[model samples]
Target: MAGLVWKDIIYIKKMWKTMLFAVLFFILFSFSRNDAVSSMALIAIMVGSNFSMIPFNYDNYSKWNEYQYAFPISRKTAVCSRYLFGVIVFGCCALIYALIMMFQLFIINEIPEKEDLLLQIGVVCFVPVMQSILFPLIYHCGVEQARLYFVAIFALIAMLVIGCSSVIVNMFCEENTIMIIAAMIIIPILLYIFSLRLSINIEQKKMA
Candidate 1:
């Protein structure tokens, strides 16, 4: 497992330019001193899940699944590792971003309160769960279509929820921050579980 992961890192190291640029851009959000930075990291992870598409494509191109066929690892592990690696990649980015945020807050005086750690945590953990929601759909449907579906559906749902919530506030005028936050946390967990089950089923079919 370690070697497989290391090999991926070694491969990624050769492509540091693109990754560094992404890290730099995302870290720029850290200076804002808004909780939304954390949310943005998770959003970055969601977009970054597409990173798996390239490697998956490479595996198909090079016929590397045959090599996995020769190995003794379970098909479950095979599927799970790709997801694991994707998370790891995003986590690394989040860490660097958090550090940048910290520097911006402390050294640059942009944010006096040091909350980058909390923000990083908020972004990092739920990403795997988000991947659980996203990966299977992309895996089975293909990337281009899945990207279209995810962005469109998610944006529509977000707009509808925001619009309706605003209307409710106008009509009844009750603000429940706790309920809102709880719903945000709960929704991701549920989505993750759903994505995991879907991913496993699709992977099993592929192995079949």
Candidate 2:
């Protein structure tokens, strides 16, 4: 499993420049001055999370999936590794966004309101939901096929988030921040568990 995760990391390293460019582009686009903080954060999280799929794309391009079966690893391990890889990538993106938010508040003298913070948290929590849908698609359909639908899926999610962020925050936020935070933690774990199971089954079928 560690080797599988490391393999994806190595692929990311090889394409570091492309990843950097994409990140920069997202950051710039998110900071386009017309968007709200929550919208910007959501876009950043989406873009960042999507980067994890690059490894799968590379795998397809190089026929690594076929080659992977030559090793001792099981399809379940391969699927779980991708999920873990996504979690790590998403975590890094979240951390970077947090740091940037802090820098904006402390250095730039721009403080975000409580509502803004809550909305950002809400947006971040939604990332795993997107991943839960996407990973199984990649596993079953192959990355190339999945990539086409990826655009549509992301656009739909972006529309929902951007269009209904206020309503979502209102429904989830209320007066207690703890409840929303708990949902953020719990919901993603549940979704990821389901996603892992689905991906494992799909990979097993592919292997068979």
Candidate 3:
């Protein structure tokens, strides 16, 4: 499983130029706008989650599925590795964005309020939820087919974030800060578990 995760990292490393460009673009955009903290965070999550698909593309190119089964690894392990890789990638991206936000705030001599930080955390949590939707489709339908639907997936995620943000704003009270934080942590985890199971089942069917 570690090797599998490393394999994905290698693929990402090969695309270093593109990744560098993306980071620069986002950084420039972040600095250009006054109200771009949340938007920058959201873009980081989206880009990082998209990076998770690179390994799948590499696998398809190499017919890795046919060969990977020759080893001791199970379909479940293979599927789980993608999720694990995604978590790492998203975590790194989130950290980078958080630092960027901090720098922005520092430059402006502003301290982030607790609620503002919580909102950022909440938005970050949605990355896994988007991945949960994306990974299953890629595993079951093939990456090429899944790529075609990415626009729709992007739209769906946008709608979900908008809806959730509205609800969070309306329902948030000082007392329920902990509750909101708990929900942000818990919901994405539940969704990931469900998605992992579905992905494992799909991979099993493919292997069988």
Candidate 4:
């Protein structure tokens, strides 16, 4: 796992733009009125920003996926690597956001425990769902084409999310927060499973 984590770190270091974007976005969110709003904003970036997506495609340009398939590592490891990359990127954004929040709190002499925790939850919940979409797109179309598709799909999701926010909140806002948390975690795991199956199927066809 250290080796895999190193691979992700090396990949991120080699590709600074995406990391920069996440940092820039974290800075943007720092200006928000509260941690929850700021955190949600960061989560929005995590879900919509595909800076890592290009590098993911680049990784495959050498036929890394094909080569990995030829190696002794299980396909699950290969698939998990891509998923892990998504988490790492999301963690970067979250960490940077937290740092900014820490600085801001120090400067302003205020602490917002509840809002900070909610934002953390939002960041944690958003990444798995975003990766469920991103990996499959990259797997089927490669990075460049997947990027184009990602843009369209991301915009659509943003629109859907915006359009549905009122409905979602109205329906679930007063409901048990535990149920909301459960759904956030469980639904994304289910979706990730579904996406993984689809991605592996696409990869197998490419191999055949």
Candidate 5:
């Protein structure tokens, strides 16, 4: 299981130079904005969302799945490794954002609002939440088609949120805040577990 996870890590290691440039660009761009802290928070979420799905593309390009079954690893381990990889990617991106945030807050003496702090927290969890939505689709549909479906689903959700923005705010008022937070926490865990199981099942039946 560790080896499987390490393999994906190796793939990420190869992209470090490119990712470093992207990080620097995002930081610099954020600093140039009027709302630097908010920009930084959104930059973090963008980075997490974009990079967490790279391994799927890498695996498909290399035909890793077809070859991986020759080894002794179970489908569960393989799927779990991808999920673990997403977490690692999320951690690294969140760390970069945190460091930048700290430097801005303490070093540069920039202060952020409470909402910005909440945004930072959301940035930290964005990738895992995205992975929970995407893994099952990718596992069942393949990377290329999955991207389309993912975008479509994301667009639909975005439109709904925009259309009901006022309602959503009212739904998460002081009285319902705890319930909303609990649902946010619980839904992702349930979805991730379901995605993992569904991915493993799909893998098991892929070439059976």
Candidate 6:
């Protein structure tokens, strides 16, 4: 599993510079527009959630899926490694985004709004939640087919988050914000676990 995870890390190493450049460019753009928080949150979501998708394309192009069975690895290990890789990517993206946002806030000598903070917290978990739905589809179908579903679903989710973030935050009181954030984190984790199991099953059954 670690080897598989390391393989993905190595595969994506070249992407780090490009992703970082895109992130810094957007951060400056958002700050200039005076909509840094929301824009950064969206950027984090867009980048973090889709980090593994390109690697999937690479895998397909290299016929890694077909060649994987040539190794002695189990299907469960392979699926689990993908999920683990996703967690590492999402966690790092979220952390880096938060740190950069804090630095930006410090530069402006401004504090983040409570609603914005809560919304940002929710959005942080949103990547894994979406991935939980996406991974099983990729395992059952192929990455190409999964990408089609992912685009539609991702668009809908991004719209909903943007449209309703403020309203939902304002609708709830401070105390309820804790519960909301808790749900945001917990639900995704549960969904991720379930998705991991489902992907393992799909892989196990695929060439059995």
Per-model RMSD to reference: 5.3, 1.9, 2.4, 3.8, 3.2, 1.9
Q: Model 4, 1-208: lDDT tens per residue?
A: 4465567567668767755775665566556634345345545554435644744755667566556556576665666666666667666655665676676589777675543444455555666677788788887777888778877876776666556655654555456777777886788779878988888787667656
Give the poorly placed runs of model 1, Cα more than 4 Å off.
29-47, 112-126, 150-194
**Winner by lDDT between candidate 4 and candidate 3:** 3
Worst 10 residues of 1 by lDDT: 112-121
User: How high is the lDDT of residue 140 in model 6?
Assistant: 82
lDDT per residue for candidate 3 within 30-125, as digits (tens), equals 668764545665676668767878899999999997788899998888888899998987787777767767775877767766666776776678
lDDT of candidate 2?
Answer: 0.77
Compared with the true structure, the alpha-carbon lDDT of candidate 4 equals: 0.64
Of candidates 2 and 1, the better by lDDT: 2
lDDT of 2 at 13: 92
- The models' CA-based lDDT, in order, is 0.60, 0.77, 0.79, 0.64, 0.72, 0.79
RMSD of 3: 2.4
Q: Clash pairs of candidate 4?
A: none
Q: Write the per-residue lDDT of candidate 6 for residues 80-107, one digit (tens) a residue.
A: 8899999997888787768766775887
Q: Estimate each model's TM-score.
A: 0.65, 0.90, 0.87, 0.73, 0.80, 0.90
Ranking by lDDT: 3, 6, 2, 5, 4, 1
Task: Report clashes for each candidate as comma-separated counts.
Answer: 1, 0, 0, 0, 0, 0
Error of 1 at 199 (Å): 1.4
Quick one: best TM-score, which candidate? 6
Put the candidates in TM-score order, highest first. 6, 2, 3, 5, 4, 1
Q: Which model scores highest in lDDT?
A: 3
> 1 or 5, which is superior by TM-score?
5
